[model samples]
Target chain A: MTVHAPSLRQEWQIGPFRKGDIIAGLLGFLVLIGLAAGVGRLFAGMGATTSLTDAYPWGIWIGFDFALIAFSGVGFTIAAVVHILHLHQFQPLLRPSILAGLFGYVAVLMLLLLDLGRPDRFYNFLLFYNMHSPLFEICWCVLLYTTVLVLEVSPDLLANLPWKWPLRLVYRLMTPVTIIGITLSTLHQSTLGTLYLNMPHRLHPLWYTPILPVLFYISSILAGLSLGIIAYKIAMAVRGQKENPAIAIGLGKGIVAVALLYLLIRVGEVIYAGELPLLLTWTPLNRLWLGEILFCSLIPIVLWATPSLRRQPWVHWVAPLSALLGVGMNRFNATLAAQSAPTSAFYSPSLLEWFSTLGIVAAGMLLWYLAVRFVMGSAVKLGYEQH
Target chain B: MTTTQSELSRRDLIKGMGCGVAALMLSSAMVAHPELAHASDGEESDSAWGILIDLTRCTGCQSCALACKETNDRPNPNQTPIGLDTDAYSFVEEKQIENSVGQTESVYVKHQCMNCLHPACVSACTVGALRKTPEGPVVYDADKCIGCRYCQYACPFGVPAYEWENPLGLIHKCQMCADRLAEGESPACVAACPNGALRFGNRKQLLAQAHAQITSNPGRYVDKVYGEYEVGGTSVLYLSPVPFSFLGFPELGDEPNPRYAEAVMKQTPAIALTVASVVTALHLFMQRRQQVNGEATVHITSQKPGDEL
Candidate 1:
């Protein structure tokens, strides 16, 4: 297990800034400026600045938070497998997953601040805690879990340090931190769904179920497996690393089992709750609901369930991309469509909103590139070359 | 926040951990005493106040709306067609309905906050910004409010209004004139009602009076009292000649809004702690077993890359 330090010349002269990077940086800068102005006007008045009304108090920001967190499920899933679950094979995927999660959560915090009518008062969740509110619990879990994540990812940032004692201490605490991170992620992911439980009539019949928390938890696991696979493959492709079939097939099989279980529970819930009747009545909402079921769950479940299909390289790549969309769309539907049933209020993210979302994602990608190319590059390079 | 290589002290860490534990204990204690959350069964026992709005007695005059504004120092009413806004605390809605004689007649209904026995807004508020008092009013403390607007979505009646036009946003809703009630004065709307359409009294008395009116004159009033059983009985009671649904009230069941969410929330603390402990224990066991067995726990297949899934 010998480590090779790159030459100073090699470190200084990696790939020069490309055209795509320039364009992305320019776009991100413009979007950040707009976001600052938008946030400024938001203080002037939420209703005046955004499309948020009393009927639709939450707009794209809340839904965007849900989507980002849902997709970030890969981080905890990978960490648990490697550190706590004792599956040493998935170790290489851990850094990328952690990077994705850290950025994803930072984006969520940014969006939440923008959405809040009084963003400055967010700390009140800690100071004047109301334990009854699911939002309160979510705040606590997010705050605590993010701390664990920072600690878990700290070793990567500090790997270049001459001293070894700090790194050893972090390594010793890794198992506990991973356990805590999993706990917090599990609670908050489910609690986000619990926020909807208070308003059954507000949620469309398609999503209103007592087992919403259970659904959220299980689907997150499914999303974790699929998202991790997709992220790993994409990173490998970007770095010119070959595919790891062991990792891909292992994740694909897990996705199949979880997807089937989630589909089963969701179907049973709707039928038992007498909402299956809505499926027959074919309204636009019902059609969208059907689409979520068919595309997100059923198709992916079948694709991953087949052993031959799982083995194929195309399926290995495409199935995860499909699953990411499926899971992301599910979050969007739950956050927007489910809550919009009672009122006629409609929301499409403003041009500014869309630009801000794009900017956040681009910023995340840029950060990932910096971390990998500068800080964690050698580790990733070695992992790819060896395994 | 930067600490030198050896400047961090053990005492500092212990002090920080102690504060953390105290905060956690305080929050858990607040959660454990569910009675504070159940306002109707706790501090509200002295006198559960209520408002009885008799639609049969209402003459469509906008005096109540006017009086409410004057009392609350609300802005000019620019209520939308659907009614309810930051400026207007209450409004009169016009509805066209056919009478028993089959002739269409316009009915004017007054709308305001329901102030439910178990208010979803109070439950939804993460910082105790909205609260239910024993004197039978759901109050808003803007000082504590984070302007999350979750109460806006949580309220069944859509009662809580956001000051969206203001640079500083906060919730606005009818607090049933808590100050007036304290001073032994009826609400401005009730006092100003020229037609005696609104009645204020103890909640039990209001319920009894509403029932007597329904049972006494069967055909004059509808069989159902609008808020009597809706969302687990609001503080406001309504009796109408026409079905309440025609006036745009949501058709809700008797179960309260809090009851639904509490069903899951009640178990969350236990579930979260239990899951955390169980998972940590399992992780430790695996760690110990891996140490003892030395690379025999997880079996990765040795088959070729093209092996079947």
Candidate 2:
């Protein structure tokens, strides 16, 4: 019997898996487990499957949902930079960021479905109109913007098609579609903060402000740009190509500017709202609030603003990672920690909740990796390459 | 980069500034007069029904809570409810308040939906599932509820409860017996009250009677009615011997909870238009500037060759 070595693609396809394959397999396993856990939760009801109580109606599902939506701002944010602002130098990162945005939103939609008690009627927002409701506005904006993201990211796949007209059509409609995406993102991103406006009685005084919409919108941009750098680096690495350091540096400058503004307004709001005293109280909630600002805004601002630190190789990964964590913490804090339960009942998400959430997120990462490898490889060759 | 091009940019900047000023002015005017942005509940106030609960007369019999469970067809109808839940729509809370001489006094307070004229839940519900009716009850439509539980955060009184035990749960809350009222019958809780603590009547008349009782017997009741002006008034009014705050009622301003949120939401269309037009204009302006400068072709991959209209 003659022994033959398997080709790279064949090896990837067959049983002799490599590192990437092992990672993909692990993610796939988690996704399958998550599907089972989700089904179990759906069949068993919220009371049995989750630790959520009437006192704390929302949990990790909502926390991740809100954070993922903010992270997905990369789609419109990068599009606005390249197509709208005409910053052509940042073009290389565009497609990858849009792909990231698409999957981020898909993951968010999945979490939302799992969170909804009546998941079957998730489309009810379309049939009913409540112009006065912040949630109503957010629902419409998310749905429309997800559609916009699909269109924005379609060209990556469309480029691979044998037909030419579909790609041409998408490119022709790109500008207006991008503008619409930006508009929708602005509405929902800010409206997420507006959702909290109704909860003055429940939310801690430190996080509750009339300017929450402003803060939320600004942070989305900051986090979006931060995530964009990470996405660009990973995309380049996946394609086995070298990345330009200038891309991260340029985006870092923008992140710095946004971070400064966020920090100023956040602290300024606290002082203006006369909640500075609460900040000094040393309560657990106050500590969490301070930590969020420190991680999400203050540290990134310092790291990116300082020339020497910004150039450091580690700063590239550390700063953006911290910013992402900060934003995630902010969302979780807003959804859970800052909320004051009327009763003594506390919440700790069940194992099923953890497994299911991890599974959905893992699936998104796996899908993004696969697309970046196969679809994006050819798509980039077809002239997404920088001149 | 030329002087004439800079001058043209200045001119465009001025035009953009003009639009910004106009938008700011328009927003300020809307802010100055909130009534311009205030969307009415579409329910006539004149014919609204209300409940008057005189806590000074409640005996803590737990009869109203049981009757509410029975009327709503909730589980364990005979069980005494300790708090608001999917099973119990209303419950009487026992509180310990200090007397003027510093002696502790026990007071019984009934807890249920406030049914505010400007209900935050109705304003925050994603699908218009919750509605403030012309007859003054804040009702819910289960079929329309996606069970997002946004209402749980929006309610000032923390009234709405979710049936967590159900596979496909829906929000459950005290609807003030809108169905019973339709049939010219009072709420089961009100009718079942043995101490005459709960009164069902026209809201305006109830307000008048509540004030009359306060004035007629000095020191018997608090000078203020609990729900009369709380969150822009509720369909239910409460008369208490002790302060409502001591009974754990959320201290609230007269302005409704949804006021700021609704005002911002009402600007959605305006915000969307402004953003779209500004972005479109900026793109056009940048493309024009690049063309005027005759810079080597702009290399946006998304805008490469086929993107041109």
Candidate 3:
């Protein structure tokens, strides 16, 4: 019997990028740009381009951008659990986790710039330090965290480099920088949700709690882990590598644990807030809350908890995707859905807004594709070296 | 000699028990009135800047809103004329409340920056874009703003509006007409109020006036002044015959908004550091264990086992 030992140096040849990949990426970027331009032209001066009113001030830009970025917390959390926690068996999953985190945060930054009425004035945040503002805290923490992420990911580049001096410098800086990055990421990830704590009146009672910041912090850890698992499965499929059953099972267990905890906390919050009565109310807010809890939290937990179901290669993909979807739904509910109560003027997003959001996401995907191809190389190679 | 002994015995017992009870009472009083004991040796004026809005007197005419726009030179909501947008420094919202008679009454509540003593927007802004002026107004500086709009999310009132339409839109909100205040003039809305619905004055004076109004007309107003204790007290105060919630006002407790965000910022770093340190220690331990085992651990194996590359 010929046994094939997995080796990093072996090159698996996939067919050349067909015309489709380039055209799709290019077209997606173009469509994104075109939508942005349209927003500039038609709604450039009109404040009405968004569904936001005095009643519902934040719309998709904030809901999607902030939530997605917070969800990306999976990167650092997984890296910490695997590298710092000494889960060597989870090593194969680390690179993709970092990559997802990088992409998620980059996307958030881009969306922030795009969402701003004046993207250029963003430097003022750095120039003027408002020690008191939660925004100021978010700005500094996010900036420092992004820099840390780059540094944390730099060791990968260093490991691949031919020279010794640069790699040595990176190695020396790696532990401290990684530690700092984890710290910064934790601060901003939770701060993003805490940013809304003051808006006790604006946020629906079901979503608003003094403990929201802590909840956000905990949820992001779970969300990040789930994202890492999903990214790994996708990478495996793309590379045609056979699934490692142990890692998959480990991730499944981790996600189930997080899901259960998240659900319990969410339930506890609602009960404490006396918002349990809201669940019975036949309102859109109640429906959204139900959907987030049911689809994102409950279903994913059940799927991941069962060992036989979790071992299936298809389950590996489904579990993470479901978990992420649940994360997305919860974030959206918190930011947009609950805020869209009927009492306020209804805000329906404009086409321009939709296209701009889509464009930003596509740009993120494009960046991810390029980074993976040029910087990280093939999944198999990235996996072996990192291990 | 017998009479003297009896008197001495009673007097000695009284003195000992009396001192113990007095000591307990004194300590309890100090605990209850620590502030009184710490009160200044010299008298100081209780001066605070505040605003008082009489909702019953307000007609919902939106004259104050128009005055605010004109004074601030804010753009018109409908047109793209040079600089005007919905950047009104102040505006009035009409909230419909059903009375006991089941009749809908529209109450015009003016909305602007609350200028809290401990403003959440001020704390939420990392770049010092939003500031609580020492004089009491929570002001915003566009030049210093990173356009994070965290102030928008952090504000319990939802006061700050982002210029989502402009390529250079900074956070635009009411600055309590800080420029006018510096000139010793009242805010545009206060001057434009036809019924004296808006009053701007030192916070102590405003609170006094608000309390007097409620006291003088017990049946005419709600007993509570809205901003006196809400979110650590705002410069803006409101009096409503109807409940504050019915006037499009949110019910918030007295705790400062920044406390929540601050709590997270305080605890996260320690937790993250602990996790990172543990991971590093484990990595070192595993590597050392492999070394001690004297067996070459397979950290990485290439696809082509024979090929060096």
Candidate 4:
């Protein structure tokens, strides 16, 4: 049954200040200061604020961008499930997830701007289209997808507005908008992996394969599913509600299903590349590479694969958390460490690099919190108010 | 105590260390890979220009490296172009090779962008920032560059250098002194070479000359002429006494780097349309199911569906 506003508002439970939120808030302020200083350092042109050299020009910005995009990326996929598949049971998850994706892409653009050598010339990508370059494709997709996200999430705002007839028209045309959104999401998400395709020899053998775009696309899907479980828990915590066991089990099943596919491709690619020897290789870099795969991937798959095990409340957070961390680590390993390993010296983020990274993350958190609390609070209020 | 913790600063310690670590990392790179920092002394010629470096005749004088650096206005002549923050368009590497008789021979090979006949960097540059000249130099236009660094990744020879320290951060690479070639000047390094090791002329003439030399003096040169069939034939040819890999060249076959991405990307439009159409059909099918289910529920309730829905 469609829920009304008054009862839906009562369904939300506002929680008291938790220990985690207080620490996060305090650290947020510190990172804000650091971010300011880092931006100044960047503009002054007086110093190099990052350990980014020619060999490895990317860092936390590019790496964490992939992770965060995955975290909020399940929106269109969820939208497809509810509106297109007519599985109205999951409709409650759709709007909040789309809003999350919108916020995530905005943050991605800002971080990418800062990462560029000439931050001023970023608009040049629109003017100069390199058809062969994946970066070019990603640039276009991000622009188009952000617009798609706005359209997809705007129906929530329309309901509150005075204009009822226009809202009805928008609501009617939503399937096409959703169709566009899903297509764009799949494109840019996979195109992110294409950036690595040009650097075949530079990228490590374990991660490098012709099907990297496929791996990136699949892993993002699984990661998006994994992050959904966590995001729901957070939203519920904010609204002072308890998580249902059924939802937790369902999310776990989703993770296991997608993760198994990812694992098959990952393992198959390793065997095909004949790079299984890298795991046995005694180098510390190889060990770190092997460790990322073992902890983030193999272990989480084990935990989520069993239905009995997934019923536990801990699996709600644990499996998804591990998947997020694993995919994040894989991205960082592939982009940052692998690129730097061939260099004469190792790469690590500098003081300013750490500062800027933390600042951006904190800023994103603050923005997401505000957007959830104010702009899209009604999403979580839907479907269970009267019950 | 909480206020005191808030007042604490982690600034001064990090600022000093940040600079120190950057310096240390960069310095270690120079020490660990001086060869990477080594400047190439290859010659640039106008009208189908190419260089042939005879490894057998060459004495590793490094005058070519020095002269090339001086001509190009490199701030540091000693450093390798491959090193981070280097502006050198040239590089020369010294490597040891073992003969059949177990005699270890030290070989000095000049290294730079191969300036391929069909350069990958040219195709990789979306903005037309990089292009191969008819005169044989693969050049970079800083004004057109967005600093995506695709060229650096695309180059099989690893010749392009990024200006990491600069705020502008444009890519720097060997342009084969196109300006000097335009003025009808021979390349500084080739002109400066005292040992007669470096040969600068038309690419075809250089190739023919290289083949003639190899055929005449089989013992003096390897049976192969590098750059003749490598990565679709580079403008810069090599006649070496030892294998090219011994002098730090990657064993790239005749295939270009752009072909790798092209094969996949060519299928993109078809794949995209197929996926869209398929997903759309599935969506319509699912919505039809919902409509059918709703009709079934209305039949049971016996109150017409419009009022209840």
Locate the minimum summed-lDDT window of 10 residues in model 2 chain B. B30-39
Q: What docking grade applies to model 1? A: acceptable
Q: Choose the strongest candidate by TM-score.
A: 2
TM-score, cand. 2 vs. native: 0.90
What 10-residue stretch in candidate 4 chain A is worst by lDDT? A378-387
Query: What's the ranking of the predictions by TM-score, best on top?
Result: 2, 1, 4, 3
Better of 1 and 3 by DockQ: 1
List runs of model 3 lying over 4 Å from the truth.
A1-50, A155-162, A340-343, A377-387, B1-45, B55-70, B74-87, B91-111, B191-198, B217-220, B240-248, B266-309
lDDT of each: 0.73, 0.83, 0.67, 0.67
Q: Report lDDT (Cα) of residue B53, candidate 4.
A: 83
Regions of candidate 1 where Cα sits further than 4 Å from its true position: A1-13, A16-37, A162-165, A341-343, A377-387, B1-36, B40-46, B77-82, B288-293, B296-309
Best-performing candidate as measured by DockQ: 2
- Cα lDDT of candidate 3 equals 0.67
> Considering summed lDDT, which 10 consecutive residues are worst modelled in model 2 chain A?
A9-18
- Give lDDT tens digits, candidate 2, residues B11-45: 55654554455445433422323332222434437
Error of 3 at B268 (Å): 5.6
lDDT of 4 by residue, B17-81 (tens): 44334334422321312221101112333358898888887777777777778888888777544
TM-score of chain B of each: 0.82, 0.84, 0.71, 0.70
| TM values, all candidates | 0.89, 0.90, 0.79, 0.82
TM-score of chain A of 4: 0.88
